[model samples]
Target: MKNYNLRSTDEHLNNLTSWLPNQTVSERLANTGFNIKYFEKLPSVINHCLPLLSALLERYDSRERCFIFNGIKCGFFLEDVYYCTGLPVDGVEVTGVVKSNNDEKEEICRMYLGVSGLLTKGKISLKNLRDRFINAEDTDYYTRAYLLYVIGSFIVPDKTGRSVDVMFLEQLKDIDKTGTFAWGAALLAHLHVELETASESSLAGHSYSLMIWAFLHIPKLLKLLPNTGRKGPDEFPLLVQWTNWLSLDLKNNFHKNLKSKFSDILDNLKDEDIVWQPYKNLQNLPNDHPQHRENFLCRTVLICYNEVVYHRPDLCPKQYGIDKPEYSGVRKEIAIYKKQRKLSGEIDWSKYTSEKGKVDYSKYIQEWKHRSESLLKEALGVEEHSGPTLSSTPSSIGNVRYDCSNTHFEDDEPEVEPLQPPPSEDATPRTQADASPKTPDDGHGSGGEEITWNTFYLAFSGQAHHSTG
Candidate 1:
């Protein structure tokens, strides 16, 4: 590989032009005039490229020159753990089980002002993430997420040989090679940014990415606590059983494959103990246990999830092209449409509003109405130009012409398959999302929808939507 470390910042900046080489991020950011708002709080956004500048100017080595993720060094202070692990805190101690008085709403949002916009008297104020995405425009959050989904598939190869965990695909002997990237984290992160895009002509996905990162990380500063003798086998079996218990959640919220495999990983972990358990002694709790882990796991496992999102970005995945069977099975056009409507638009009804913000929310919004209205749209994954499905006679759901002609350009961030609850009326997958034939706008979705599901979003107003937010 060429020595990226040797280049100067000036040279690298110019080189980046060749890599990204466009104004996609800035253009889309203009859609919501988000640059102004984003800068209002974390003004450093304007100079995001500075880190690269510093690396180049200072002549950092080859490894440093690479875009390293947050988990590399992996250590932090106790105070930082709250945000890192997304635990709750009181003075200096960890307060578990969330401070929400309502039993239904487990706070897990963690980013951007820390409170939920979708609640009233608790009880999953909305339905789930798919609902959030379908109606995101009520809050206007889907702008960037949709774009990144497109870009991630466009730029990176789906099946990469690289992975964050060395053992991720090791046991699947039949599979020779995975992709060169870790897509799981990226998929999760992508869900977050798209949530920001739900608004009409709103902030850029990069801005949302940064915000979610703050929500998940800033407080605890993205620290992963030392493993307290948590075993995989113990936890895996329990997790598998719980996955079945949460079948409605898995089926409704994620893809069919995920739903099928939700219970499919058991045999893999049956022989391993370290792979199952997360804590040393299930009964014996650590005195310093971060409170958020309980709530975070609550939503995913049987435990409640936080209303606030954690920016544990180390878990965030980077871009890779979609060719690998694990993630990609279609082309750009169909991929783009799926992202715009099917993916980010889903609702996350697990949350309801409270003060401490479930799972530790971001200290954002500064106002209730704004957080409930505009900000909610930003988080739900709605978008502009949302309209009646272009036409009915387009043959397959993935064959119609889904247009984003006027959209601001942005690079793909990642794809996130959220953990959600399915619609009571959800129908069987009608058709596969068609891959664009080397054409960027070949509209389609793999197993795309034939009818609009009204997935749900920004239901804080407790009303049906007219169109895309």
Candidate 2:
């Protein structure tokens, strides 16, 4: 397999470090719910870690949508995005196309960059954006421009790697409302889409989250590097604690020994080797902090403008201390899902949701609403131990990895319902009311399949039949 290289605009991010010390800028960023204090240190803290990333990508199972490290399932989730970057997890879905007219685009260019018609070419140069805003006055314009830079450069960059998309300017127009966008969800969705095709020669999207997640969960991996000297539990948006943690020599050592060491660690990994709940006792966050919100259980389609990806938290039940289930039939379900995506073609999710009602996520919505019931008995404050112990051996059948390429689909597999647009913007949550019944009239009949947390775990544990189109 070819080694993948990470692509980011960290240089542009570094150039904007001058604004990090501006009190006004910091206040404005905090007001928007963004944690920019650690940003200045990113240039030094962020290294390619090519070998580590390449090894991880090599083990990524697209069908299961996570990496199988020594038989333990783990992947980036929305909560990770929130903890790592401190981006808001709930708010208006950051979707919809860039509808700014040429005049409006030029006006934004003129107002922000002191240059007219720069966006006529479709994007603004990162250098021009940085140079203009780096020393500009400490006002709303500066804050908006800085946010645009963060979005285009760090949050959801395009393939160019040297320019910021003018389209994001629409969301930044109202600086105060910027905090209301579900930035964390969008970042996670973008990263998920990137990971699906990561086997290629190059991988893009915010890889910092992936690196930090590995360090947080795998103690052995972090031991290979120099100590970060973090004295206590990290604050919310844990990325801040990682600043200036790696030295030049340490990075070189990683490039030299990362692959061999990483393999050895995973090869001999034990049940206790993984840190299942790193954030459970964060010193700065209260038990009821919004950072601990259960939105992580909401398995739904994460929409970032025209891009859409599935957020399947149910696959990694152990992350929540839940008992692993024995059987699952989601392999066929995911295969049919891919086939449906192909049949549907590219959908502008924002337009699709508005024109046809919201995509039917009722199945996962109902599951998320009752997440507490799925927790392990111990997690519910019971004294006696029940369910299987963490160290209990998994079924041997779960160890056999199926070749997705050889799997075939049959017509008897469960049928997924087509989209049914709602007539109005009703406030009701899309639960049972929006779901199609498994009746013969609905075409699925009584034998129609329903996916639950247990079934998803089957797919993750490699116990499900590996079949895809």
Candidate 3:
């Protein structure tokens, strides 16, 4: 087998590091003295990879789960998953059951899990490593968030039918007054994610704590005002008015205080038009505006992500989507928008035009809709409407390595030969001469009268037969 990059998983994952906490197998190997060809059960492999997975979870303040595909580079097949061992990850498999036979593969996964749990609990937190500086709280959040997202990706792809319980996320729902705001933000984001994206099969118990508040309190976070007129989606205050802080006079100090680490969260907020010139005027605000956390500005970022990131992750500023971006690059963009909003005092509303932040939104949704012209033609398979494209080359997609030879039948040139031959006139005359002309067969000879089908049937009568099942 070709050596597919066992690093594919690491690279795909590493691509997201610009935004979130990052730890790669390559980096871990370098740090822990792990030899690429060493035994699968080496101490360094376990010691290095375990806590690394744990630390990535909440590392950069995002909660995205993406696949780290080393399959192509590592020469993996679904069948090989049971044998994950060796390094870089030669031909070993890391999936399937890791517990039953006490297999080496299982042991490794178990070790990784244990390390992750410990890191999330914080005994293994890192301080200032490799010129990259992070505080205790920042370190804890990123590590935990990254691990959970990675674990969740393992549990479900296509974001469906999750079996792993991320109850740990619920543990992060409440932010203590002096520490990480990750708990509350995660809780709220969890609610939005579950409500908007979780598969029905997933219980979403991890987010049970915040779903009510999302329906009740979160719209207020979108605007610079406080919520009024009471509860629920039906009674939701205007998205623009929710954060309007009748107490806007209280200094809009949501993020300026050193105690709150919420600036990271605000920075991660996605905005659509910030890229093109169209919405460039939106973030125009005064550099010293009293509001440190602008609700309307944050909401605009979400709107931008909803437009640019959701439909196509490719369009997102970073591979990881809305939660993270290349930290420095994204922050620069946010700073620009901050300037826009502080100076302009409003976003582009002439186009959307509802009384407040609600635009019926359907008009914007219509922009991306596809036309339905050929669907009927396609269903009928009409060549005029849906003709097949001609290509001389073979497709690589769906190509299987196994042979295409027929497995079911014996090969023989049977179609060209007759099953039975007619007797010649001379032979017929002889059988008739024996008196077969008056009956179905000649009773005397030619072996016809001597043998009976009944005798033949009895010889094979005891052979076994399979039941219909």
Candidate 4:
């Protein structure tokens, strides 16, 4: 892993550090004393991370549950979690569950859940954190928004299904109304994109489930946005990110082998039982937005099931075309979705327009300009800004070493063989959608096999299958 300077003074870093703790990173790390390698319980990790957490609350001046934490605007927390333990940031066994038999791995998992617990429901209410800093005149709303997001990302509940806490749903709605945390929404959306890309079966399946749950509930936030009429500032970038990930995943066959397992699960479900709660909850959203989420889900399922229906037929008896007949090529639905959304792989933020806030994208616009200049320099073979990338020596934070060189770059980068160029805007469209399950004599041929609701639920919830893909 290449280690970038943590103290580098640049337009981006300056903007970020402006909202960080008053002290330097090293000073803050020392104040936290988070140098333990193995924690037997989650409380231990919480106790250690509290200083860092407190510093964040002190920076944001609002007594509220919502804040944003773009990994860029704020220093990343997952890496710190990894620093506390030797565990890979990709996490042990992707499911993120530590095996009971392995004391060390189990401890790591406990620590992760524990840290999340502290942020969301720890004894010190995040409300209290806000009160402490609420009087600061120089409070950075962007930082506050990002901080709230950091806390929310860890807000996943223990149960899956209809058992989600009512408080959480209400909290999501309240936060969404604020409209200051679009960056958080965008970050969670990006997580969903990452999950789809890494959908291969592995321990990572558990990580995927956590993200899926986040996606499932995000509509609660989306539905509550103020009447801006336009999409939030983060929406288009997220869409572009999602499409690029899918395009790249296809090229690398990331979802190829695992596609059959989804079919196996889907084929066992009965037509009437395919309704997922997440899809049903979006009823209050504008027709276009909710439909888009549904389309994404259906398209993803089609990709997994290796079944497609070119166009959703009106004559189909089923509520969703997912369960009915209509034959076309695999991944065809996804292709059409990409076309309708105009999700080109490249995101030109310069062309982005949103009415969310005053100076809504001033910071991002600056960053984009910087990036463009860097590219121009690279093109011209200029070395004006060149310098050696300095990495930090290994230092034990908790149990794991914080050596910058050991970062999880390999785990994160997509493994693509013979990398393919991103698809051009004018690239020829592919074949149409494949057939979904359907009964006979429906004009279209009978959809091959039917899948039971129980089967799909089991696979999706990680009860029947351990892998994600």
Q: lDDT of each structure?
A: 0.19, 0.47, 0.19, 0.19
TM-score between model 4 and native: 0.22
Q: Candidate 4 lDDT, tens digit per residue, 1-469? A: 1111111000010111122333332232222221111111111111011111112222211101111121101111121111111111110001001111223322332332222222221122333334444343432332233233222212121111111111121122222222221122222222222222221111111122222222222222222222322322222112112222222221221223233332233223332333222223222222223212222111111100101111111111122212222222222111111101111222222232223222112333332222212110111221211221111111111000000111100111211123122123255422111211111122111122111000000000011111111
Which of the two candidates, 1 or 4, achieves a greater TM-score against the reference?
4
* Index of the highest-TM-score prediction: 2
- Structural similarity to truth (TM-score) of each candidate: 0.18, 0.67, 0.17, 0.22
Clashes of 3: 55
**RMSD list, candidates in order:** 24.8, 13.6, 33.4, 24.5
What range of 10 consecutive residues in model 3 has the weakest lDDT sum? 452-461
TM-score, cand. 1 vs. native:
0.18
Off by over 4 Å in 1: 1-46, 50-203, 206-289, 295-469
**Which residue segments of model 4 deviate by more than 4 Å?**
1-132, 139-273, 276-283, 286-320, 323-406, 411-469
The per-residue C-alpha lDDT of model 2 at residue 361 equals: 31
Q: Once superposed on the true structure, which residue ranges of model 3 sit more than 4 Å away at CA? A: 1-193, 198-211, 214-297, 300-469
Q: Per-residue lDDT of 1-469 in model 1, one digit per residue for the tens?
A: 1111111110010111112212443344334221212112211111112112222112111111111221111111111222211122211110012222322232333121123444333222122322343334422233322222222221111111010110111211111111112122222222232222122221111121121122122222112112212222222112112222222221112222321231222112121211111222233223334322321111110011111122221111111000111212111111111222222121222232222222211121111111111110011111211111110001111111111111111213222333222212244421111111111222221122211101101000000001111
Give a tens-digit lDDT track for model 3, residues 2-47: 0111100110111122223334432332232222222121111100
Best by lDDT: 2
